[model samples]
Target: MYHVHLPKLEQMGLIEPSGNWYDIRRGPRFDEIEPLLRVIDDHRKKLPGDVL
Candidate 1:
């Protein structure tokens, strides 16, 4: 799955990868969506279990 998604994310400037490491540090796209992601995480944490 890394092979499939990492390149697409990199192409979209959402992430950067070097060797075996993925850089998910704050960036333009990440900054835009981080709040939404945090909201989703908070919601998931509120769930009972097995939300995925």
Candidate 2:
């Protein structure tokens, strides 16, 4: 899963890996989608796993 998403994220300046860890600190691209991500996260938490 990491390999699948890494290239696109790197292209968008959203992650920088060092050693074995991925750095997910704030970046311009991430900022642009943070609000939407937060909304989705909140919604996800409210839903039951069976419904999901």
Candidate 3:
């Protein structure tokens, strides 16, 4: 995930990696997906077990 997922998300402006490479923070575009994440969390129990 360090080489694949993290870089992909970073490229999309969804996550920002720390200078030391040991931490991460929300990127500028995080707001774009925040609503979707909230909806998913709100209905997580109703979703299929494997969906998450």
Clash numbers, per candidate = 0, 0, 0
TM-score against native, each model: 0.58, 0.58, 0.80
Global lDDT for candidate 3?
0.90
**How high is the CA lDDT of each candidate model?**
0.67, 0.67, 0.90
Give the local distance difference test score of model 1: 0.67
> Candidate 2: where are CA atoms >4 Å away?
20-24, 45-52
lDDT digits (tens) for residues 4-51 of candidate 2: 777677678776555544545544577778888778777986877854
Winner by lDDT: 3
The global Cα lDDT (0 to 1) of model 2 is: 0.67
Clashing residue pairs for model 3: none
Instruction: Tell me how far the alpha carbon of residue 40 in candidate 3 is from the true structure, in angstroms, after superposition.
Output: 0.4
Query: Candidate 3 regions off by >4 Å?
Result: none
Between candidates 2 and 3, name the one with more favorable TM-score: 3
TM-score, predicted candidate 3 vs. hidden true structure: 0.80
In candidate 1, what residue range of length 10 has the lowest lDDT sum?
A: 19-28
Check candidate 2 and list the clashing pairs. none
